[model samples]
Target: MQQRDSIVETRSFDHVPESERHGTVRTQVQFWFMVNATLITLFTGAVGPAMGLGLSWTLLAVVLGSVFGTLFQAFHGAQGPHMGLPQMIQSRVQFGSRGAVLPLAAATIVQFGFAIFFIQTASSSLAAITVDQIGLYDVLIGAVAVVLAIVGYNLLLRVEKFASYITLANLVLVTLAAVVVLPIGTMINNSAFEPVAFLAQFGAAATYQIAIAPIVSDYTRYLPSRTKGRAVSAAVFGGTLVSALWLESLGAALAIAMPDSDVITAIHDMGDSFGYGIGSVTMAVAVVACLITCSLSFYSGSVSFLSALEAFRTMKSTGKVRSVTIAIGGVIVIAGTLLLPADFLGAFTAFLSILGYFLIPWTAVNLTDYYIVRRGRYSITDILKPDGGIYGRWGVPGMISYALGFIAMVPFFSTAIYAGPVATALGGADIAFAVGLGISSCTYLLLTRRRDFSGEFDAVRAAPLNTLGEPQRSASASTDSMEGNIPV
Candidate 1:
């Protein structure tokens, strides 16, 4: 047994010289939990409501989105921890350092938008819960942003622990509600439980899946390489399958009881009546759980965008500067969410669609470069230095494949006009994301055959090798043993 370190440590991969330091198993598990929490929260607020209104097809649309979206995310996300770098750094192997910027920038902006969406959600909830005290909500959001910024990436682990407790408690309450309701004859015959057309069900499921695709990696990146496949399975199933079931069942039951109110209101109504003493508590728990989940969305968005900005070469160095950037970015996202009408959901979906468009091509390139082109092996050293790096300045094959993937999805997604018939047919604006993921994955694999971009492939490369200077071995490549300083 390669005795796993009890403490986190950065170690050089002997076989892959250019790879980034890898994450530990515990970090990976926490990451997976956070991913599940984030998805559950997002769906509860956005997609869950849609399903309540739309029913079967709405459920189906969200599910379909999961099928396609997860395929791309699992493949790409599984590649990250194995490589020990953000998706953008991994792209340099194929896109060339400069070429990688296009997709990185796109993903960053989209992620930032999501962060904004979360701030908007939490702030609105605070505002509503407090009777429209605008400044209070804004301050609350600002506080969260500042705290997250201060805590940095370590927050991913800490937040998950807090969220897990709330989620577990809520789960128990929901289960109890389910057990209690199942025996009631009235619950079975509720109007909200009425069956819907098959097509509509499919449409709803598709939309929900697309909406959550961009953030899949935010959680997946921390997964341990050894457990990557299983973690992906758990994340996709737990997040999409379990979440859909919870929301759908709740929606149906609530619909039957209220007959006309929204699902959240219905849930609240149940607390007033038969929920015994747990109704108010359940509602409160659910609201707080959703808020925590949204806060994570904003945090992950900040990380992704900050990573993108750092790629700019012109941005100031130091994680602190990046933290400040993330804080500012979070505020901007809130502003965008607020400036738009209360129908921010539609705009949010559109923004996500654009992100999906880019993520598809990017994921395709990532997976292809990792699995097929390199045959699941790469030098850690080549990644750091631009000139001597095996990836070279720009990989024409990767650039071509990425371009081809992007172009193919555009017409189907109708991204050129920011409107697609698929959205209309799908009954929500999430289909474009799925289409982009599928097209890009297949196209990239087809375009790039098993060809090596560079010859020398060693492990544990240094940073800023291109325009910066001669490649100095990163801390990982030092002769000193990496005992407890590995990055997650």
Candidate 2:
């Protein structure tokens, strides 16, 4: 074994001890984490509100956003399996140790923000249900959500496969219920909900998808590199595309019937349209499915925030933070839920619109660093340093590129102020994400022309260890006689 000292400047990726790196995370444990974290069922519940808003627009958003988001995030996911590092550490190349704080903070906030959105909507909906059963217990629902967050990611990972399988079944049942509620001809031109009219729905859908993009790697990292692309495609299709369609269509049909009802009631009405037995089961499945999503969202978001907090120089100047951050985030989410209304679209869309602004730039920067400049290879050592690292501490080129993209995007996104209609006409944050990505990619290419071609791709592109978590001694970094093979 190589007796290498830990780099004082390098941020620790995960707490996985050196000994454990060759162990646990390699097998089924991590695979399930990816699958469950991508919870398609919970995504369905979220689309419910959009259904009432406009189904056609919702579906269009999923199709466009999922395709684009999946393609970009897949590049980031490529790093996890290839480099065996967390997203924040991977980001250090682009953001610098100090500058990394911005993306980290943005990711953390969006994660926790959405966690709050999902948990609140689910809890509030559950409260409405449980109140009739146990007599006015909304607080009870919120309390249960917090407890779920405390249980953390590992437990959730174990339950996710089971939850997702059941949730898929529930989706089939609900789709049938929607058909049952409104026979094909019984409903007015269902196409009316399509994007032909309401552009806001497209913007809303794009924003929502952007909000969820960061967590793609949290799940995909577990996948073996050979199938990483497949996993990415599957997650995009199943979680975003299919799930969004379910929510939008179901919500729309319910609205057409009741006009004034919320998503929960529409679902309830769907169940009622069937017999009492089917209704009871659908309601039960919906609640459980929503809880599964909220729990995962809260856990992922908490981890992101903790990673960001750790990046702060004043905090630890490393990419790690205290466990308490999770608890605090959960509490805040719970509080937000209580404060916000139960309508999923109101809170989720508003949050996503804000998230899309920064998230687009983050994605652009990472893609530029990984694909354009580094060409899918980076020095582990360079990324560990706080300053004057190989990639250069606080990469100004990357940061400036992101800033420029953000500047261009803001006028379109912040239309409520001066350029309201102009911003709206500019096509919301989704366009911002794309345009920023293009600009950042072009900037990185133009700036790093000579430096981009030096590394040996073969040595760097070693298959990502299914088990490794800690920064092991890479072949280049090792002094041991048996340098090539990592200790089993």
Candidate 3:
């Protein structure tokens, strides 16, 4: 790990030494809280009301979905301290050093998509607050986020910890003001329940929470290895659940209050209802929160991109490499935001659904391999090998399970572009994510059952200590010792 006061983080894909481990579970809570409490989540919450679900049903769906999705997401956080590597880098264990590229590519796209959406939403809110120079706002916000990402992990945590307090206070005020100013009782009375609408709302909320799975561990990987798994999981679950439910429920209320207006404009109007200048302040705070999220996506996306590249060639985790990747990602985000369409909400809904679809199977396979099959014991030296050492170039069980899980979801998928037959018969309630999770988990377990892991366990035991106190062996030597030693 880099020095505590270093402005730019030096380590990228390398393992963090025990001596450098820092941070508490409390910081984890604040970081996740700040990340989820943003305009994007508010937009996600608005989906329920837009789908014609009553506020009551929207709230119920949000609660249930948040709980279910966060359960998977929070568990990923526990993997960070144990693996001491970037989330996707650790996936090399399940998917092989090379085969991990499949999930890495998906994770990279998801992060980029999130960065684009966050920047677009923040720019729109800024435009709503002042002049309509959305193009300029896009560049300005993207530049700030890129710089913050370049500054890297420690600084990002500091910024989020500070922003968490401000966002929390502002969100509470906005939620309270909406209840007093909006005709909530009238909106609830006017709307009626539809099963399809309720399920769609539930899916939206669930995916919104699950979207963080790929990057959740990136933030926690620097913590001490002895950190309690349950403590980390609980903190993450609590932080994400509370913030998401609050902003999303507020979004549902705002959508109910003004069905035709965009969420940002509706929030502005609601803030103005409280007072004259409060709307501008509220919008400004929202922009700050969104910027933090953009930085997070850029940072994690750059790390994932590097992990993917390592599958093909040797890559260094230097500051220069990190800066270049982030710069490239920022340019893409800026260009994408400039071309954003007018139907932002509709586009956002579809994006969330698709993002969740690709990610569900990957998360399912990863979590099962970690907690069930390998039981959190991994050989870091083998994971770093170009040929994948004991694990090999492609993880047959993981790859096949991922493909099978995705295939199983095809008939149940319900997206804007295509609705599967099962989905159509069930009134268009998309439960494809759940189906993928179950299929992937079960498939990976069943396939690995007959394989012998005793040799792999011995390799893990013989591996050098993951601390600065020990001198690590060359990659060649490590690979030579493990070659032909473990059975497939």
- State which candidate has the highest TM-score: 3
* lDDT assessment of candidate 1: 0.50
lDDT of 2 by residue, 1-488 (tens): 21123221122244222331221233333333333232222343334233343444444554565555545544555455445456665677777766777777777777666655555445445554555532123345445555555554344555665666676776677667777766635454455553322444444444445555566555444344333433444444444444554554555456556666665665766676776555556666655655666665655666566555444443442312323555576667666656665455454655555665777877777766665555555555455444525555577877887788777765556423233344556433224555666776677667667653434332332313222223333545322322222211
Query: Candidate 2: lDDT of 467?
Result: 22
Worst lDDT 10-window in candidate 1: 8-17
- Ranking 2 against 3 by TM-score, winner: 3
User: What is the per-residue lDDT of model 3 for residues 193-260, given as tens digits with 9 covering 90 to 100?
Assistant: 88887887788788778888999889998888778878888889999999999888888998988888
Q: What TM-score would every model get versus the actual structure? A: 0.71, 0.74, 0.93
| Candidate 1 stretches greater than 4 Å from native | 1-31, 34-68, 127-130, 178-245, 248-262, 276-279, 314-317, 337-341, 382-388, 414-434, 450-488
* TM-score preference between candidates 1 and 2, better one: 2
Span of ten consecutive residues with least summed lDDT in model 3: 466-475
Q: Which wins on TM-score, candidate 1 or candidate 3?
A: 3
Local distance difference test scores for all models = 0.50, 0.52, 0.83
**Model 1 clashing-pair count:** 41
Tell me the deviation in Å of residue 448 in model 1.
1.8
Candidates by lDDT, descending order: 3, 2, 1
